[model samples]
Target: MKADFLKYQAQTTPHPLAMEVSYAKGSYIYDINCKKYLDFVAGVSACSLGHQHPKVVNAIKNQLDKYLHVMVYGEYAQKPAVELSKLLASHLPAPLDTTYLTNSGTEAIDGAIKLAKRVTGRSEIIAANKAYHGNTIGALSIMGFEERKQAFRPLMPDVRFIEFNHELDINQITTKTAGVVLETIQGGAGFIEPQDNYLKKVKERCDNVGALLILDEIQPGIGRTGKLFGFENYNCVPHVVVTGKGLGGGMPIGAFTASYEHMITLSDEPKLGHITTFGGHPVIAAAALATLKEITESNLIQETLEKEQLIRKHLKHPLITEIRGKGLMLAAMTPSADITNQIVLQGQEAGLILFWLLYEPKAVRITPPLTISNEEILEGCDILMSVLNKIQPTN
Candidate 1:
C-alpha cells in the first residue's frame, strides 16, 4: 500500500508522512497496526468538531437521503446551501450579506479577486509578504513569497506585495488597487496576528482609496479562534471575507461573502461571471451548516481561549522561543528549522500527530480540534514534550 501510494498519488512533498490510516475518531487517529496517535494538527485546522463528528456526519447522511447537486451554484434554492448562507450572513456585519460558495478556499480566493476587479474596475491586487492565501493560479499570483512562485511566473498581472503588520505599507493601496487581500491572522507566516489596529488602519485606507479589503479567514475563522471569525477579535470588518478549512467540519468547502449590491454585478453584467458546478453541493453544504450551527450554539467558541491557555501553560520548554497566535490557532516556535523538523518527525513516533506551517520553517503547527478535551491536550503535550526532551538544544 505504501509503494502504491507513492507511485499512484501525486504528493506535495518529496517525503510525505504517509500514515496508513485505519480510521480516526475524536482526538486520535489509528494506524493500520492499530497504533493510536493523539492528534494536534486537526487535519491542518480543518476538522473543528473532530473526526467523523456525529452532527456533521448525520447532516451529510440526511442530505444524501434527500438529493445531491441538482444544479449549478445560484441556479437552485437548495435547503442546506440556503440555510448555511443565511446563518453566515446573520453573523457577519452589514453589506457582507451575500455569499458565493466554491469547491475550495483557493477557488473562493480566485472568485474574491474577480469580484474585486468587477466591483472596482481595477486590476491591481495587493497581498502581504509571507502570507499564503492558497495555490490556485490567481491565488499564487498574489502570494507574497517570491521563491515559491518564481517557477510559476507570468501569473495574474498587477498583483503587488506588502509587509504584514507594517503600518507604513498601508499607503501603497491607492485608487488603482482593486483589492487588498490579507489573512485575518497570517497563517503561513507563523500565525502572525494583526498588531496595533493594523487591520483597522488598512480598512480605513482602503475606504479612503475605494479599494476593497478582503480578509482570508481560512484557518483562523470557523470558531478555531475564540470568535466565529478572527476579524471580530481584530475590531475590523472587511468588505470581503474568504472562509474555508474548519467551516466544513472535515468536509471540503469554501465561501466568499460580500454586499448584495456588489455581488449582483457578477451575475448580470457578465451573466455567469463566476460559476462553479459543484460549489454548493448538498452533502457538503449540509455538513457545513451543521458545523456552523454547532459552533454557534455551543460553548466551543469560548472554550478555545481556555484551551489555548491550557496549551500554553503545559507546552513550555527551553528550546521553545515563543508561542504566537491566539485561541486554537497557535505556532510554537523552536529555535531553528532543523529543530522543528526533528520535533515534527519524532512527535509521530512518540504517539502524537504534529505538522508544520508553510513559510515558517521554525514553527510547529499545533492547531488541534476545538472540541479537544483538557485531558487530550495534556496527553498530546506530554508526548510532544517527551520528544522535545530527547533532542539537545543546539546553540
Candidate 2:
C-alpha cells in the first residue's frame, strides 16, 4: 500500500509523511503495523470531531438510506442541505442567514468573491498579507503571498493586499472596493489573531465605503476556536462568512453565507449567477448538519479553551520558543525551521502526529480534534517533548 501510494497517488510534496493508515478514531490513527499515533494536527484542521465520529457517520448513513444527488444545488429543497442552511442561519448573525454550499473552502471563497462583485458591482478586492483563502485561481488571486502565485500570473485582476490586523490600512477600503477578504485568524500565516478590535475597525471602514467584508472562517469555524466561529471572539460581523474545513466533521464541504438581501443578488440580473452541481451534496450536508448539531448541543465547544490550556501547559519546553493562537488551533514555534522540521518528523516516528502550517516553515501546527481528551493531549505532548529533548539545538 505504501509503495502504491508513492507510485500511484499524486504528490503534494516530495516528502509526504507517507504514513500507511489502517484506521483512525478519536485522537489516534492506527497504521498497518497497528502502531497508534496520537493525532495533533487533525487532518490540517479538517477533522473537528476526529475520525469517524458517530454522529457524522450516522448522519451520512441515514442520508444514504433516503437518497443522493436528486438535483443540482438550490434547484430543489433537499432536507439535509435545507436543514443545515437553516441551522447555520440560526447560529449566525443577522444578514448572514442565507448560505451557498460548495465542495470545498476554495469554491465557497470563489462564490463569496463573485457575490461581492455581483452585489456591489465593484471589481476591486482587498486581502491581507500572508493570508490564505484557498488554492483556486479566484482565491489565489486574492492571496497575499506573491512568490507562490508569481508563476500563475493573470489571476483575477484588481486584487490588492493589505497587512493583517492593521487598523491604519482600513483607509484603503474605498467605495470602489467590492470586498475586503481576510481569514478571521490568518491560518497559513502562523495562526495570527486579530489584535485589539482590529476586525471591528475594518468592519467600520467597509461600512463607511459600502464595501463588503468577507471573513474566511475555513480554519477557525465549526467550534475550533472555543466559539462556533472565530469571528465571534472579535465583536465584528462580516458581510459574508466563508466556512469549511471541519464544518462537515470529516467530510468535505464548504459554504458561504450572507443575508437574504445580499445572497439574493447572486440571482436574477444574470440568472443562475453561481451554480454548482455538487455544491450541496446530500451525504456531505447530512454529515455537516450532524457536525454542527454536535458542536452546538454538546459541551465540546466550551471545553476547547480548557483543552487548549492543557496542551499549552504540557507542551512547554525550552526548545519551543512560543505558542501562538487561541483554543485548539495553535502553532508551536521552535528555534529554527530546521528544528521545527526535526521535531515534526521525530514526533511522527515516536508515535505522535504533528504537521506544519502552509506558509510558516518554523511553526509546527497543533490543531487537534475538538473531541480530543485531556489524556490524549498529555500523551501527544509527552511524545513531542521527548522528540524535542532528543534533538539538541545547534545554536
Candidate 3:
C-alpha cells in the first residue's frame, strides 16, 4: 500500500508523512496496525470537532438521504447552505451579512479578492510578509514568500507586500488599493499575532484610504482561538472575512462573507459574475452547519483558553525557546530545523501526532481538536516532553 501510494499519489512534498489510517474517533487516530496515536495537529486544523464527529457524520448521512447538488450555488434554495449562511451572518458583525460559499479556502480567498475589486473598483491587493492564505493563483499572487510561489510564475498582477504587525508598513495601503488581505494571526509565520493594535491600525488605515480589509480567519477562526473569529479578540471588524479549515468538522468547505449590498453587485453588471457548481453542495453544507452549531452552542469555545494554559504548563523545556499564538493554535519553537524535524518524526513513533508550519522551519505545529480532553492534553504533552528530553540528552 505504501509503495502504491508513493507511485500513484502526486505529492506536494518529496517526503510526505503517509500514515495508513484505520479510523479515528474523538482525539485519537488508529493506523492499520491498530496503533492509536493522540492527535495534536487536528488534521492541519481542519477537523475541529475531531475525526468522524457524531453530529457532523449524522448531518452528512441525513443530507445524503435527502439530496446532493441540486443546482448551482445561488440559484437553488438549499436548506443546508441557506441555514449555514444565515448562522454565519448571525455570528458576524453587521454589514458582513451575506456569504458566498466555495469548495476550499483558496477559492473563497479568490472570491474575496474579486468581491474587493468589485466593491472598490481597484486592482491592487496588499498582503503581509510570510503570510499563507491559500495556494490558488489569486491567493498565491498575494503570498509573502517567494520560494513556494516562484515556480507558479506570472500570478495575479498588482499584488503588494507588507510586513505583518509592522505599523510603518501600513503606509503602503492607499486609495488605489482594492483590499488588504491579512491572516488574523499570521499562521505560517510561526503563529504570530498582531501586536500593539497592529490589525486595528491596519483597519483604520484601510478605512481612511477607502480600501477593504479582508481577514483570512481560515486558521484562527472556528473556536480554535477562543473566539468564533480571531479579529473579535482584537476589536477590529473587517469589511470581508474568509473562513474554512475547522468550519467543516473534517469535511471540505470554504466561505467568503460580506454585506448584501456589496455581494449583490456580482450578479448584475456581469450577470453570473462568479458561479460554482459544487460550491454550496448540500451534503458538505449540512456538515458545516452542524459543525458551526456545535461550536457555538458547546462549552468548547471557552475551554480553549484553559486548555492552552495546560499545554503551556506541561510542554516547557530548555530547548523550547517560545510558544507563540493563542488558544490551541500554537507553535512551539525549537532551536533549529533539525530539532523540530526530529521531534515531528519521533513523535509519530511515540504514539503522538505532531506536525510543522509551512514557512517557519523551527516551529512545531500543535493545533489540537477543541474537543480534546484535559487528560488527553496532558498525555500528549507528556509524550512531547519525553521526545524533547531524549533529543536533549546532554541537558
Candidate 4:
C-alpha cells in the first residue's frame, strides 16, 4: 500500500512521509504495522476531540439513520443543521446570529469574502501579510505570500496586504475597502499572536473606514485557543467570523457567521447571491454539533491552558529558540529550516508526529488534540528532546 501511495496517489510535496494508517483512537494514530504513534499535529488542528471521538462518531451514525442531504443551504430546515446553527448563535454575540455553513474552511472563507463585497458594495480587499485564508481561487486571492501565489497570478485584483500587528498600517483600510480579512492568530506565519491590542486597533480602523472585519478563525476556533474563539482573547468582535478545522470534530465542515442583517443580505439584490449544493450537510452538521457540545459543556475548554503549560514545561532543548501561540495551537522555532526539518523527520522516526507551518520555515507545528492527556504531552516532548539532543549545531 505504501508503494501504491508513492506510485499512484498525487503527491503534494516532492518527498512525502506517506505513512500508512490503520485506524486512530484518542490522541494516537496507528500505522498499518500496528505501531501507535503519538499524534501531536491533530490532523493539522482539525481533530477537536481527537480521532474516533465517541460522541462525534455516534452523532454521525445517528444522523445517518435519520437523514443526510435534504436540499441546498437556506432552502430546507434539516434538524442537524438547524440545531447546530442555533447552538452556534447562542454562543456568539449579537449580529453574529446567523450562519452560512460550508463543506470546508476555504468554502466558508470564499463565502465570507463574497458577503463582504455584497454588503459593503466595495471591490478592494485588505489582508495581512503572511495571512493564509484557504486554497480556493477566491480564498487564494487574498493570500499575503507572493511566492506561493505568484504562479497563480491575476488572482483577484485590488487585493492589498499590510504587515500584521503593524498599528501604523491600519490607515491603509479606507472606505473603498470592502473588508480587511485576517487570521485572528496568523497560523501559517509561525502562529504569531496579535501584539498589545493590535486586533482592537485594527477593529477601530475598520470601523472608521466603514470596512468590515472578516476574521479567519479556522485554526484557532473551536476552543483550540483557551477561549472559544481566538478573537475573544483580543476583545474584538469582527463583522464576520469564519471557522472550520476542528469545527467538525473529525468530519468535514465549515461555517461563516454574522448578524442576521449582515448575513441575510446575500439572499436578494442579486437573488440567491451565493448557493451551494452541499453546504449544510446533515451528517457533517451532526458531527459539528457534537464537537461543539463536548467542547463547551465539558471542562475541556478550561483544560487547554493546563495542557499547554504541561507541553511548554516539558519541551526543553538548546536548539529550541522560542515557543509561540496559545492553547494547543503552537509552534517551536529552531535556528534554521534544515535543523527544523531534521528534528521533525527524526522525531517521526522515533514514533512521534510533528509538522511544519505553511509559510514558516524554521517553525515546527505542535497543535496536538485538545483531548491529549498530560502523559502524552510529556512523552511527545521527550521524543522531541531526544531528537534535538542528537543534532550538533554548526558554528
Candidate 5:
C-alpha cells in the first residue's frame, strides 16, 4: 500500500507523513502495525468530534439509506442540507441567514468573493498579509503569501493585500473595494488572532466604504475556538462568514453564509451564478448537521477553553517559546525552525501526532479535536514536552 501510494498517488510535498493507518478512534489513530498514536492535529482541525464519531457516522448511514446527491446544490431541498442551513442561521447573527454549500473551504471562499463583488458592484478585494483562504485560483488570488502563489501567477485581478493587525492598513479598504477577506484567526501564519480590536476596526472601515467583510473561519470555526465562530470572540460580525474544516465532522463540506438580500443576488442576474454538482451532498450534509448539533448541544464548545488552559499549563518548557491562539486552535512556537521540525518529526516516532503551520516553520500546530478530554490534552502535551526536552539545545 505504501509503495502503491508513492507510485500511483500524486505527491503534494517532497516529504509527506506517510503513516499507513489501519483505523482511527477518538483522539487516536492506529497504524497497520497496530501501534496506537495519539492524534493532536485532528486531521488539521477537520475531525471536530474526533475519528469515527458515533453521531456523524450514524447521520451518514441514515442519509445513505435515504439518498445521496439528489441534484445540484440549491436545486432540490434536501432535509439534511435544509436542517443544517437552518441550524447555522439560528446560531449566526442577522443578515447571515442564507448559506451556499460547497465541496471544500476554497470553493466557499471563491463563492464569497463573487457574492461580495455581485452585491457591491466593486472589483477590488483587500486581503490580509499571511492570510490563507484556500488553493483554488480565486482563493490563491487573495492569498497574501507570494512565495507559494508566485508560480500560479496572473491569478484573479483586483486583489490587494495589507498587513494584518496594522491600523493604518484599514485606510486601504476604500469605496473601490468590494470586500476585505480575512481569516478570523490566520491559520497558516502561526494561528495569529486579531488583536487590539483590529477585526472590529476593519469591519468598521469596510462599512464606511460600503465594502463587504468576509471572514474565513475554515480553521477556527465549529466550536474549536471557545465561541462557535472565531469572529464572535473578537466582537466582529462580518458581512459574509465562510466555514468549512470541522463543519462536516470527519466528512468533507464547505459553506458561505450571508443575508438573504445578498445571497439571493447569486441567483437571477446570473441564474446559477455559482453552481456545484455535489455541494450539499446528503451524506456530507447529514454528517455536518450531526456535528453542528453535537457541538451546540454538548459542552464541547465551552470545554475547549478549559482544555486549552490545561494544554498551556502542562506544555510549559524552555524550548517552547510561546503558545499562540485560543481554545483548541493553538500553535506552540519553538526558538528555531529546526526545533519545530525536529519536534514534529520526532513526535510521530514518540507515538504522538503533531503538525506544522503552512507558512510559519517555527510554529508547531496543535489544533486537536474540540472533544479531546483534559486527560488527552495532558497526555499529548506530555509527549510534546518529552520530545522538546530530549531535543533541547546543547549550546
Candidate 6:
C-alpha cells in the first residue's frame, strides 16, 4: 500500500508523513502494524469529535439509509442540510442566518469573496498578512505569503494585504475594497489570535468604508476556541462568516453564512451565481449536524480551556519558547526550526501525533480534539517533552 501510494498519489510535499492507518477511534490512530498513536493534532484540526465519533457515525449511517446527494445545493430541501443550516443560524448572530454550503473550506472562502464583491459592488479585497484562508485560486490570490503563492502568479486581481494585529494597517480598507477577509485566529501563521481589538477595529473600518468583513474560522471555530466562533471571543461580528474544518466531525464540509438580503442576491442576478454538485450532501450534512449538536450541548467547548491549561502546564520546558493561541487551537514555539522539525518527526516514533504550522517553521501545532481527556493531554505533552529533552543542546 505504501509503495502504491508513492507511485500513484500526487503529493504536495516531497516527503509526506505517510502513516499507514488501520483504524482510528477517539484521540488515537492505529497503524496497520497495530501500534496505537495518540492523536494530538486531530487530523490537522478537522476531526472535531476525534475519530469515528458515535453521534456523527450514527447520523451518517441514518442518512445513508435514506439517500446521498439528491441534487445540487440550494435546489433540494434535504432534511439534514436544512436542519444543519437552521441550527447554525440559531447559534450564530443576526444577519448570518442564510448559509451557502460548499464542498470544502476553500470553496466557502471563494464563495464568501464572491458574496462580498456582489454585495458591495467592489473588486478589491483586503486580506491580512500570513492568513491561510484556503488554497483555491481566489484564496491563493489573497494569501499574504509570497513564497508559497509566487509560483502561481497572475491570480485573482486587486487583492491587497495588511499586517495582522497591526492597528495602523486598518487604513488599507477603503470604500473601493469589496471585503476584508481574515482568519479569526490566524492558523498557518503560528495560531496567532487577534489582539488589542484588532478584529473589531478592522470591522469598524470596513463598516466606515462600506466594505464587507469576512472572517475565516476554518481552524479556530467549531467550539475549538472555547466558543462556537473565534470572532465571538474578540467581540467582532463580521458581515460574513466562513467555516469548515471540524464542522463535519470526521466528514468533509464547508459553508459561508450571511444575512438573507445579502445571500439572496446570489440567486437572482445570476440565477444560480454559485452552484455545487454535492455541497450539502445528506450524509456529510448529517455528520456535521451531529458534530455541532454534540459540541454545543456537551461540555466539550468549555473543556477546551481546561485542556489547554493542562497542556500548557505539562509542556513547559527550556526548549519550548512560548505557547501561542487559546483553547484547543495552540502552537508551541521552539528556539529553532530544526528543533521543531525534530520534535514532530521523532514524535511519530514516540507514538504521539504532532504537526507543524504552515508558514511558521519553528511552531509546532497542538490542536487536538476538543473531546480529548485531561489524561490524554498530559500523556501527549509528556511525549513531546521527552522528545524535546532528547534533542536539547548541552552547553
Q: How many steric overlaps are in each model, in order?
A: 0, 1, 0, 2, 0, 0
Query: Residue pairs in steric clash, candidate 3?
Result: none
Question: Residue 389 of model 5: what lDDT?
Answer: 82
- Across 1-395, the per-residue lDDT of candidate 4 in tens digits comes to 98999889898889998889999999999999999889999999999899999999999999999987878888988988989999999999877899999999999999999998998999999998999999899889888888888898778888999999998899899999999999999999999999989988988888898889999999999999998988999989999999998999988888999988988899999889988889889999999999999999998889999998988888877788999999999999999999889988988889999999889999999999999998889889988999998987764
Which is the better candidate, 1 or 5, if ranked by lDDT? 1
Assess each prediction's global lDDT (C-alpha) against the native.
Answer: 0.94, 0.93, 0.94, 0.91, 0.93, 0.92
The residue-by-residue lDDT of candidate 1 on 176-262, one tens digit each, is: 999999999999989998999999999999999999999999999999889999999999999999999999999999999999999
Off by over 4 Å in 1: none
Q: Tens digit of lDDT per residue, candidate 6, span 131-247? A: 888899999988889999999998999999999999998998888999999999898888888899999999999899999999999999899989999898998999999999899
TM-score of each: 0.99, 0.99, 0.99, 0.98, 0.99, 0.99
lDDT (C-alpha) at residue 102 in model 1: 86
Clashing pairs in 4: 95-259, 96-258
Q: Which ranges in model 6 have alpha carbons more than 4 Å from their true place?
A: none
Pull out the clashing pairs in model 2.
Answer: 95-259
For model 2, residues 1-395, the per-residue Cα lDDT tens digits are 98999999999888899999999988889999999999998999999999999889999999999999989888999999999999999999887899999999999999999999998999999999998988899999988888889999989989888899777888889999999999999999998999999999999999998999999999999999989999999999999999999998988999999989989988888889999999999999999999999999999999999999998888889889899999999999988988999998999899988988888998999999999999888888888888998997776
Error of 1 at 347 (Å): 0.5
